[model samples]
Target: MHIGITGASGFLAQQIVRDALAHGHRVIPFSRRKGEPVTGCEPVRTFGPDIDLSGIEAIIHLAGESVLGLWTKQKRERILRSRIDGTRWIVDAIGKAPSRPSVLVSASGAAIYGNRGEETITESSATTSVGFLAEVANVWEAEGQKAEAAGTRYIPVRISLVFGKNGGAIPLIKNIFKSGLGGKLGSGKQWMSWIHLADIAALFLHALETESVHGPVNGASPNPIRNEEFTKVMGEILKRPTLFAAPEFALRLLPANEASLLLDSLRLIPEKAVQTGFSFRFPELRAALSDVLA
Candidate 1:
């Protein structure tokens, strides 16, 4: 398979590319830069609607502005526009392609479910969650769905909190716990759905290869943990004391209600993946953390 990946240099994209290459697939990395090389892949300069994707067999759209910083008005606008516009461009490119790719594995987020408390979130769950991140995810997935009109299988992977060694949120969380400043947010009862970097990468490949797997696939482990339990495991792994906690009021004081990202409870279930015979290497949080921290 010849795969075209947007945001190919990103943390998660890099892992996916490595896995794809290991599986004997040709990777074409789409980049905004004219001649920047993506290691071990064919690099293409993509800018605006005129972009060409002639022979690309599949596309993994992962380009977007990071949602980690303080959500000022400008930051919020950037986050929304980057996803909406970037997805729109990809759909347009697919429409114009001489031969449209068989599948499009675009990135979505578990935040689309919003603060669902203890409700088990699956691909079939209602996306009635209302908030900035939720809205972004909803619109982002909708835009990617447009590719289906061009005769492509569009699978929007609604990703959870990704745990990895070198990148994603784990490094920062590990650092905080190592410094003994780590603790649960709010009441610590909120659910957190997470996936190891390797598992998520493999899930993308599974979705790409499996024809029956369509629509929104939850990129999370079968076992979702509470915030308190996650904190406890992190402390145990790092041999640090998690004695502090970030209260709701203090978190809400941050710009643009960034507290929701931490406090929102989503007990996600990868029902589609499991039903389709996909296996997870690290289904438990403790084992996943041990491998990542090691």
Candidate 2:
């Protein structure tokens, strides 16, 4: 299977490229910046003729801006436009090709189910949060919906916090831990759906091959760990005492929109992925943290 990715340079997309290539799938990586190997896969600037249709099995759409930045009007526009416009371009290109890819594994986020407190969320869960993130995610998924209507085998993967040694949010978290500053955020009881980086990469491969998974799929582990639990476990692993806690008022200095990501509660479940006969590589939070943080 030949796979092409939009945001090949991203942390998650880079992992997908490596996983696909290792599985003997030909990968045509597309990124804004060219002439670089994103996770061992050489990335090209343009989505070329070679990637239009023939022999292309799957397309992983992960290109988007980091939503953690200060949501200035322009920055927020970039965050939304880059995804919506980029996806629209890809959808247009896919529509023009004689033969479209069998499956389009488009990227979304679990933020769509925003701040659901202690209630466990599934793929069918309703998004009631009026936060900026939920709104962003709503529009992001709509961009993929256009592809699905075009007769493309579209699947919007709503990913959670993917933890790996490098890249993703884990590196920053680890750095804070190494400095002996690891502790709870706000109340620290917020639920965060985390998956080991390896599991996320594996899930993409699994989705590409499996025909049964077509719509929205959750890219997460079965176990959703809480903020306080994660901080406590991480502190224990790093052999550091988590005595200092970041107050919500102090956290507002970084970025306002990002606070929602850091402090909110979301008990997400990977119901669709687990039901597809796909086994989790690291099902427990401790096992996942140990591997990535080791």
- Using all chains and alpha carbons, the TM-scores for the candidates as numbered come to 0.97, 0.92
Give the CA lDDT, 0 to 100, for residue 260 in model 1: 89
Model 2 score (lDDT): 0.81
**Winning candidate number (TM-score):** 1
Please give the TM-score that candidate 1 achieves against the real structure. Answer: 0.97
Regions of candidate 2 where Cα sits further than 4 Å from its true position: 37-55, 252-254
Clashing pairs in 1: none
Give the poorly placed runs of model 1, Cα more than 4 Å off.
none
Per-model RMSD to reference: 1.1, 2.3
